[model samples]
Target: MMTKSDDEFLDDIFGTAKAQPTLVPDDLMARVMADAQSALVKPDGAPKQSLFAGVFDIIGGWPSVGGLAMAGVAGLWFGVSPPAALSTWTAELIGVPVSVDLFGDTTAYFAETQIDG
Candidate 1:
């Protein structure tokens, strides 16, 4: 007959405890999941929003809508009537001479000459 040493016997007992499967009741897990789902809240007790309404809320309600409208108007106004100094100011900032006229492009020529000198 073979016999296990004291250390081997202790190790076998502890190893079985480590390998044992823990059984949780199915109803307990269901109750836990339900509690978790209930804990994830919707703001102001409101029900779910439609897709468009959700997008509108994500874009920050009314103020962002007004700002977007104003930006569109400003872009249209600028495209129709550009300021005269816009050309000279852009020329100075870019370190080149530019004519406000778009008929014959020569800005690249001036830029190359200035860069070489």
Candidate 2:
């Protein structure tokens, strides 16, 4: 069997044929444009949000609101009942004796110190 060159094999397979162009019908193009125009048109009298609602939307909705509420509550709790270390530090700074009980009432201790001093 004789071996054929690469160009000879390709030319034999393709035979210099040009592909035919495809055209979309005018009716189909018109329908597509009409659908696109309808989609692009805005509805009449769209509902407007209040300033607060717009701000909430900018901050990413309900999860962000819940997170902000939780942060506020945490801040309030920490402000009312500070950590043990902070209390100890404050007591030392004020020349007051530190209490032995970790969860003891700090107000009672301060009252006793004030009475004794």
Candidate 3:
């Protein structure tokens, strides 16, 4: 048995390959061109939104805005005055004593300094 060279193999494959011309209907070509043109062109007075506005649009718009606002307000409230139950639970979980003072010794030290001055 004789082995064929790489060039001979490729030549045999290409020798059987034939070039064929594809014919598309004129109306189909016209419609395709019209669609391509329409996609490339933008309509007049179309307002371009900023990145933030685009993100808000994708997140259900006004409802998402209201949700974000509510979350921020809730975070502010929790930071100012966290519930005693929450503080106690956290202290117990961390194996630490729950002090009655919210600001701890830092606030007391600052108050004493102000009084002395």
Candidate 4:
């Protein structure tokens, strides 16, 4: 059970009073308005970026570009001719027969399927 002192302490911290607006000094308010107006104004000119720099920024920085290049090369390599291990893994995953030289047969899985013969 909560004590009365604890209840009073909680009420003091989270009082039911509404928030009241505080008045700002005229000089400080004027300075704040001036700063806001200055921030809204656009600069006259910015330095031009080269085509390569602009393209680089658009596709993210050097790290992202390097990753993309590596991914592209890997994709091309896999598309042209995948390695034997990858083929074996995919074949096992898909439960399909792979024509790898020594250890690619799925004869063991024949028991799992209901073949009439």
Report the C-alpha lDDT of model 3 over 11-106, residue by residue, as the tens digit: 777876754456898999999999998787576757788999988889989988899999999999888999999788887889786458678779
Q: In each prediction, how many residue pairs overlap at the backbone (N, C-alpha, C within less than 3 A)?
A: 0, 0, 0, 0
Stretches > 4 Å off in candidate 3: 1-45, 97-117
- Writing each residue's lDDT as its tens digit, candidate 2 over 14-83 gives 7655344568999999999999987884666567789999999999999999999999999898799999
lDDT by residue (36-85, candidate 4, tens digit) is: 98787456655678999989999898999999999999999998999989
Per-residue lDDT of 42 in model 1: 64
Best by lDDT: 1
* Candidate 1 lDDT by residue in tens digits, 1-117: 545687788899999999999999999999999999889786877677899998889999899999999999998987898677875776678978546777456888888899999
Query: TM-score of the candidate numbered 3?
Result: 0.40
Task: Say which candidate scores most in TM-score.
Answer: 2
Off by over 4 Å in 4: 1-42, 47-55, 97-117
Ranking by lDDT: 1, 3, 2, 4
Off by over 4 Å in 2: 1-34, 88-117
The deviation in Å at residue 82 for candidate 2 is 1.1
Whole-model lDDT values for every prediction? 0.86, 0.85, 0.85, 0.82
Pick out the ten consecutive residues of candidate 3 with the lowest summed lDDT. Answer: 13-22
Candidate 3 C-alpha error for residue 84, in Å: 0.5
